[model samples]
Target: MSSQARVSRQIIIQPTGEKPRKDRPMVHYKDRAELKDSVARAARTVWPGNARISVEITGHWSACTGRIFVNNRDAASFAPIVPRTAPETEAFDFGGQAS
Candidate 1:
């Protein structure tokens, strides 16, 4: 993308991909945490095994909502969620000359 384009010649561009969707799908509660809990309970009922069943919800809030499906029967390939990094401390270098 060139930054030198004049305002008059600029063309509006829309983002491509699965547009924004709500992390919470249902309209029952306005909270994403609430939805997660509700889904966990429902999932437990559906999957009785204690082998480790996890539910992940993702999407934007306005556009098309998300749906859930089970993939435990086969190895589910997924990228782990990246953890937020800690804030860095600003450094002030002291003159190397010995006191």
Candidate 2:
């Protein structure tokens, strides 16, 4: 007889304030080291930066799931800021000569 296992994963992204659109593809590993390696590879590809990553694994022998959290540097500071203003009521003269 054959048995099946249930697996799932969740990836959380920080600083960018974004999350994965869907669960990551499940992967089977022979040992804990293999699982760590796989997760590390995925993390590098998903968040390539000087970010902190953490993984949580849970489940019984027949199945396993994980959650990966990545805290990246804030990127909003590089964005340009635009000032909001009301519409001009009158047209101003651009030339040096007074209107």
By lDDT, the best candidate is: 2
Tens-digit lDDT track of model 1 for 1-99:
323211111111111233322222222223444444544444444445645544444453111123334444321212111113512221111111112
Candidate No. with top TM-score: 2
CA lDDT, candidate 2, residue 15 = 25
After superposition, the stretches of candidate 1 with alpha carbons farther than 4 Å from their true spots are 1-28, 61-99
lDDT of the candidates, in the order given = 0.30, 0.39
The positional error of residue 90 in candidate 2, measured at the CA in angstroms, is: 73
Give me the displacement of residue 5 in model 1, in angstroms: 45
**Which pairs of residues collide in candidate 1?**
21-59, 21-60, 22-59, 22-60, 22-61
Give candidate 1's error at residue 36 in angstroms: 1.0
Residue-level lDDT tens digits of model 2 in 67-95? 56566333211111112342232122111
